[model samples]
Target: MALTDLYDRASSLLERRFLKNAFLPVAVFPVILSWPILIQSGRLDRLAAWWESLSTAGRIVLGLAYFVVTWFFAAIVASQWRNIIRLFEGYPIERTPLGQRSADWHRRRRTEATQWQHYLEYPDEDEVLPTRLGNILRTAERYPFARYNADTIVIWPRLYHLLPESVQRDVEDRRATLEFLLVTCLFWAAFGVADFIILSVTGAAPWVACLCLLVGAVGATLAYESSLSAAMEYGERIKAGFELHRGQLLAALGLKTPGSLEEEKRMWRAFDKFVRQARPADMEQYRRTSAPPTGGA
Candidate 1:
């Protein structure tokens, strides 16, 4: 395929994936959150009667309006995708008191759990994040650096382009799943809070409001846990992409493929320096006019 066509295909795939991921939270969550208010206010019966009274054409117009509003919200949510991921990843919050305390607590828990040498390895204390989702993804992001001395943040865009279309599809699929789950978790939490507040303000029974809150909390917790598992799968796909296709990446860059593990690590470290600081890493010695062999070392 021509290069421009390939770029267009990738862009189109990404847009579709993003819209799919955005739809549930934008379209479903509002209805879920409004139920308690509707019930508490005794508005559902009135709304149903009103809806039944609408002319067919009026009902069609309302339906169209609902679709347009949901699509608009989805577009806004999709535009803020990076920020949403960061929020789930607990970024700037790490500097806050609550975040610091939570991180320290998690670090201690992991340390205790892994104190025995036979126990499974965990991320280092310094890499621990305030949220479980953040920790799962942080470990994934650090995988290249931890294993190959490659800075994944700097290398991923280049490496992704070099990946096979099948591998790229798998990675994108996993990412979309993770995004969907994270958004669900956030929306469920919002629903629970909104439901509780509406119930209380409308003079609903205290137990009823608490029940709604509990339902929302349970939904959010379940979604969050599912997202953690999704993240693990997504992380593995990413690690595999680097493990299996990194040589292709080097070859595409017109660089000689490293012959040994140590040599590859050294090359990655030097390339990272070059990419991050515009430092001359004497990379010319590694460049080759001929294409390097396919597949990873």
Candidate 2:
């Protein structure tokens, strides 16, 4: 098959959310980041002249090539979305001295902040992460465990399947917004570094290079701060999802729903243990009297 046809087929297989959250940012970043550099280097005028000289067929071919290249980059970025999230979450950072120092600073700030009133978006001081976004998300991940003894990391995927369609959409939309902001933050930070290096190497006006760097830095900072709020909203949706659908999760697992909050907590603890350890004995008392209904029935 032709390359464009292959691109079409592959992109069609991805969901709309993936394209919005993963593809659009990657596709737009180059154009946004390159404009100032092109202008400063006097390449913009030459590029325009070159474009005007192209035949109709050449223009079409060039546009297609650009689209394909951007699409390929977007695909790569999309594939790494999970890893990017983990990076933003500051996982495995205690090994590095800088990371350890950052973690300690954030821990102290969180401790001071929570001394007066508990913030929903703040993780426990002991569990504090190096980044604000990380701590916000960690707080959400720990919510179910703290309140109901349910291990959210273990239960969330199954709980998501049990959520109503409307609830699922709400959760997915919030998560997509958070991811978009994070990706934008990374792009702008990269743009700042690349723009500074390229401008310095090309001997562009010192003021111009500094201005571009400042713009990029500001954009990155704004995106990162916005991502903190997005993370909190996404976390709230996760909390709501567990609150509203956890019983459905129990039912889906062929377990009986508990009648009281205390019973529910105990049931969740047992279920979590059974899931993690494959210990059927722990869940024996929680099993439903009747088997869960099958699709064909």
Candidate 3:
């Protein structure tokens, strides 16, 4: 089975309300996980006290950091809630439409090309995005959905347009990954800070504050994870690139309205046959993604 299928199975299991409720406690395991690190470093108790004293603005900043940290996990749960989430293992293509998928490729490519036009075009703060993105885009254009706007394509030519392209070509798109993880780390940090703050502000026993904070932290962590899973729409886009409108692919592969079980079965086998041979990652034969999406056939 494909990664999408595996994700479907896992999600099906998570759907049982009892399972999700029981699993909620693990969300706050981050607190426990950080115990050794923070305790050995002696930052946990200090943070707890600071949270008690933080002004509303400081709290708000910490809150935002927490949100950022847990976004991906939240996005996944929300997908279950909205019925729009489809986990294709680690890829994003499974969830997006072909048109939008194509558009993203076009947009990324254009961003790539623009930086190459001149030295001034190079962004001072960040290196070009399109070039690194080109690896995935180049791999995706194989399925027919890779077609999109021309203006977008001219920007990121490929992994070999210029010295800059070749140099940045192998770089991984880890910005999203790092940002997601950073926010997750911040969330637990805020909990420890809150524990200290509550004890100081309310004159509560330190142990009592910890117990209350732990429960709240767990609930908050899971809820936040659910929300992030909903918002992190990247992996879906990756899966969409691979699947490429199964209906259209069905037609393209020469299967039509089925009249019998035998015919449908035959077509299914044929799809598997083509899939094994023409996987988009194959990259050698179908190197081109979208040739300006010609106006006519």
| Alpha carbon lDDT at 152, candidate 2 | 87
Model 2 misplaced regions, further than 4 Å: 1-14, 114-119, 290-297
Displacement of residue 50 (Cα, Å) in model 3 is 30
Instruction: Compare the candidates by TM-score and give the number of the best one.
Output: 1
Query: Which runs in model 3 stand beyond 4 Å of their true positions?
Result: 1-186, 202-297
In order, the Cα lDDT scores of the candidates are: 0.82, 0.82, 0.40
lDDT of 1 by residue, 1-297 (tens): 698988898898877776677865788887787877888788999999999999999999999999999988898888877788899888879899989998988787786674441122245678788987787788778888888999899899999988888898899889888888878888888888888887898799999899988998999899988988898889889888998888878877777868888988888887887887887656767777675554532
What's the lDDT for candidate 2? 0.82
Show model 1 residue runs off by greater than 4 Å.
2-12, 113-121, 289-297
The window of 10 residues in a row where model 3 has the poorest summed lDDT is 81-90
Over the stretch 140-184, how does candidate 3's per-residue lDDT look in tens digits?
A: 332122222111122123211221222222221222332233344
